[model samples]
Structures are given as structure tokens and as C-alpha cells.
Target: MNDSFKKIAKTIKKSNSIALFTHISPDMDALGSSMSLYYAIKSLGKKVSIFVKDNITETQATLVDTNVFEKDCNQSEYDLFISTDTPSQKRLGDYAKIFIAGQRKIVLDHHLNDDLKGDLNFVDTSYSSCSEISYQVIKELKVKITPQIASYVFMGLSSDTNAFTNSNTNASSFKTAYELTLADADITNINELLYKTHTTKEIDLKKFLYNNYHLENGICFCLVTCNDLKKLNATKADCDFFSSELINMQGANFAFSIIESTPSFYEISLRSKHGYNVRDVAEKFGGGGHICAAGAKLKYESIEKLKDTLVDTIKYSGE
Candidate 1:
């Protein structure tokens, strides 16, 4: 990755304009990598356009300026299209055509089973968070890591690792945290926003999870229907932490959250402790991610059918 990093740096240095993208339903790792790279590229006096779909979460607004994401752009205008933290074409939403149309393509991701290829690919599953890779790329680009950049990178690293309590956290993650701290990362604010603060809506969602989750055969799971969201006055953001929390159960080896964003449409967020693998389960549903943490979004005929099938899959296959 060292030589590849330098090569990507050279490519960025030569490009006059660049477009940046991340997966839809962006998480902190996705936003942190894209936003930090956007600023780093802009500081080099290059034109930058970033596109992200479904900016429907409050946490997203708190981390980056969603206003900067371009609604439309002629892909031909950019010399390079760089995708960060996005692993597949469908994950790009409608922007896949734009990336395909770019004069050059670069992929910076840390996910498994990638379907989105690039002229310059740097996909490494060893990374704990895409922000760690972004920090290295920013360093290679010779961009000074200001407090703002440090804070953004820190947010992604901490969030993805669940404040470094997750299985993915490693020496590299801690090293990045140390470096970001030296660069004056605003960890205090990020901690407050990500971990400490929770609205009444989130509290209600948590209570519902406590009352509703099913624990069977060492699998703890919850299914939050669209009607549940309406009754609670909450959104998908409120349920983001449910899967992680479920995995924290002492007796559970596998945990999953099935969220119905719309009727007959479900988003599966899977987590596994004790070395159980869930990435294959996500891939079976046409989704892919890390081993311990993975997700897939698909439509089903009914919530009951989806739950039954997913539970059986985990029982017979995911373990």
C-alpha cells in the first residue's frame, strides 16, 4: 500500500479537478473519509465536487456540511472521480454512471467483497475504518492536518470502532488516534455528539429494542418496522446503534437489526461477537462489508418472511 499511496498522491497532484463520492446511507466512516478528503483536495487549489445521496440523518448534518454535496454534475468536467468507503456500484446509487464517465477513477475503501473497481484501486480490508486510510492518503497528498481534518478523521475512527471497544480496533487505529490527538483533533466534541448525546426519540427507540428484541440460539435480533418509527417519531439514525448494542449482550454470539425503511423494504445491520462471520450473510443478500460488522439492504415480501429467513440463514449458515 505504500507504493500505491504515493501513486495516488501523484495522481491527485496532477489532476486539475476531482469529484468525490461515498455510499448512500453514509455512516461516520463514509462521511469522515469523503469530507476530510474533500477539504484536503480543495486546499490544493483543485476544483472538487462531492455527491452523497439520502442525507436524511441528523448525525450526518452535525459532522459535515451536507450543502456541499452536488445534486447534479457533468462527470466529464472532472479529471478524476474518487470514491471513498463505497464498495459496490449500486452503493453509489444513481452516481455510478457519473463515476463510470470520469476520465479516471480511484477507489479508497476498506470493505470486503468489492464490486466497484477503479483505474487506481486501494482497497484494504485490514483497515479498521476508512478514515484511517483517508488520513494516510491525506498525509501522502502532503495536506496539513488541521484541527478540523483531525476532528473529522477522529469521528470516523471512533464511531466505527464504537469508541475503540469493537473487535476491529487495532494498533493502527490507536496510532491514528494518537497522531490525530497530536494534531489537536476535537475528540471532546465528537465524543459528545456521537456517544454522550441522545434525544428522547433515541431513548424511546432503545426502550423498544429492549422490549422487542428476540434472543434465540445465541442470536439477539430486532425488527423495527416503518410503523414503529412513525409511532416513536424516530428515524433510522435512532436505530443505528441497536445492532451494536445487541452484540454486546453477554450471551449473544450474533446480533442483527432489521429496519424497514419503507413498506416491503428492509435494511439489515449485522454484528457478530466470538469470531462469528456475518459478511457472507450480507453478501448472500447482495450486500458486503467487514466480518464483524456488515450490512445489506433489500426488499422482502413481508417482515415475517424476512425475519424467519434471516434467522434460519444465521442458524444454519452464518455460524
Candidate 2:
């Protein structure tokens, strides 16, 4: 609809081979948007490859064709590189090199981080999800939005908006969802897969969260140590939505879930309600995300120290 979108369409039209990428620790939005674009580009007879450096969560994996992603790819092979849902190039992990190697690069994102790294950038923070922007881009390319593509787009929209329950959901998100449905996207299956189904291990993790959690200064928080994960035979994927679950507490203004991925490396997920901006809290620890939902990773020392620091950070930021 604008000059940039037209340029992006032209770029994709001119390219023969395209590589699609999302940030590391791929979520439903990242995977969904990337896969949706992949299908759209492939339909144009362009050689397309999607790369993911990390294992996708089982919940997100169910939404699309996972076989299209190659964990290992030659960075120098692609003609055009497109990054979706990634705020910055550093978040690409090992796949950043592909972006650097490509003859041209484009970025489609919804985060406030506007440090544009792509040759052609489309960063719209007003949109609910990058998938929403991607849907528009795919349409601009004049590619027929197939049922599979619509399903992938719908998964991204649903996941990032928490099935349209989060603060980011708006009129545009609903309109996009309706369009995807008209294209034959399976909204029923997408909702059931993302929200309704949970494995025994996942259920155990939820139980553990309820049994062991702390509430202070309007922050409901929990820590899952590597030992705890091992005892429960659960992976980080099993605790995927724990932070969101924490924010569901009766009086919680915000929530945090800190997971020790290794002996000294910890990953944190934060969610906020009541107009709290968790992004500022996440940025304090070298992480970035949306206003209401964000994440960070830090080195573990002692649980007490980490908890104290985070409590102070969230309290200070929220005020």
C-alpha cells in the first residue's frame, strides 16, 4: 500500500532464491510468520528455505510444516534474506550470517526496537504481530493466499495475542483473523492445539508452578531450576506459558518465570497486566520484547540474589 511495501514486493519478485528467518528460541508467532512467508514465496517458484537455530516448542511445531526448516544452512546461498518477528539481528543467533551474506535483506517486525538492519525494513509497532504485517506483504506480492498459508498466519496472530486475550489484540487483529478464516484457515484446530491440549509433563509443570511460586509487590514470580526440570522430566518447552499463567493470579500486576537452562545460565519470561511495561524490565537484563510481554536471560548466582535483583527492577520500572 506504501512505497516500502511496493519495494519489498518488487524485491521478492526479482529474487530467485529466498531464505526466511526468525529469532532464536522460536515461538508460535516467529515460526508461524516465517513458515507462512515460506509457503507464499515457494508458491512463486522461488527456492525458499527457512532456518531455525533452536528447537521449536512442540506446541508451535504442531501449527505448520516443520520439515521446511533447516537447522544448518549455507549462509552464502540465498539471493534474498527476509527476517520476520525478530527485533534485531543479534536475536538471529547463528542465522545472522545468512542475513549478512544475502544480496538483499528485508525485515518485517512489530517490536519497538527500530534499529533497522535490513536493506528494506518494515517495522510497524502498531500491528499486533509480525504475522499481521507478513500477511499484508504476502498479499502485496500478488501470491494467492492458500489455506496452509492462512493457517500459519492465523497461528501467529493467535499465539502472539494469546488467542486474542492479550492487550495487543485490536480491531486489526480481529479483521486479519476473519480474513484468514475466509481463506479456509482452521481456527478450531489452531485454538485447540495451542490452548486446549497439554501433555502430562506440561500439566506437571503447571502444578509445580502453582505449588511453588512467590507473590510480592504486585509481581507473581516462580523459578524453575534445571534440577527441578530434570526431576519432572520436563524440558523448557513444557514451561512455555508459565509466565502468562503467573499473570493470571488474582492480584498480580505482572509475572515472571525464571528457568535455569544450564548450571549457571538462566532464561526469564515476563508478562504484565494493569498497564505495566515488562519490556523495560527485560531490557535491563539484555532482553527485549513487546510492552506487555518480554523476556531476558542472565547468569545464575544464587536464587536469592536473582530474585532480589528482579524484584527491585520490576518494582522500580512499574512505578
The numbered model that scores best in lDDT is: 1
Q: Relative to the true structure, how large is the alpha-carbon lDDT of every model?
A: 0.87, 0.85
Candidate 1 ranges beyond 4 A from true positions: 1-3
Give me the runs in candidate 2 sitting further than 4 Å from their true place.
1-3, 114-116
Tell me the lDDT of model 2 at 152.
Answer: 90
Per-model TM values vs. the true structure: 0.96, 0.96
Tens digits of per-residue lDDT, candidate 2, 184-228, equal 998899989888898776778888999999998789999988899
Cα lDDT tens digits for candidate 1, 73-129: 787789999998988998998898888778898999888636788889888888889
Overlapping backbone residue pairs in candidate 2 total: 0
**Relative to the unseen true structure, what is the C-alpha lDDT of residue 171 in candidate 2, on a scale of 0 to 100?**
100
Looking at model 1, the pairs that clash are none
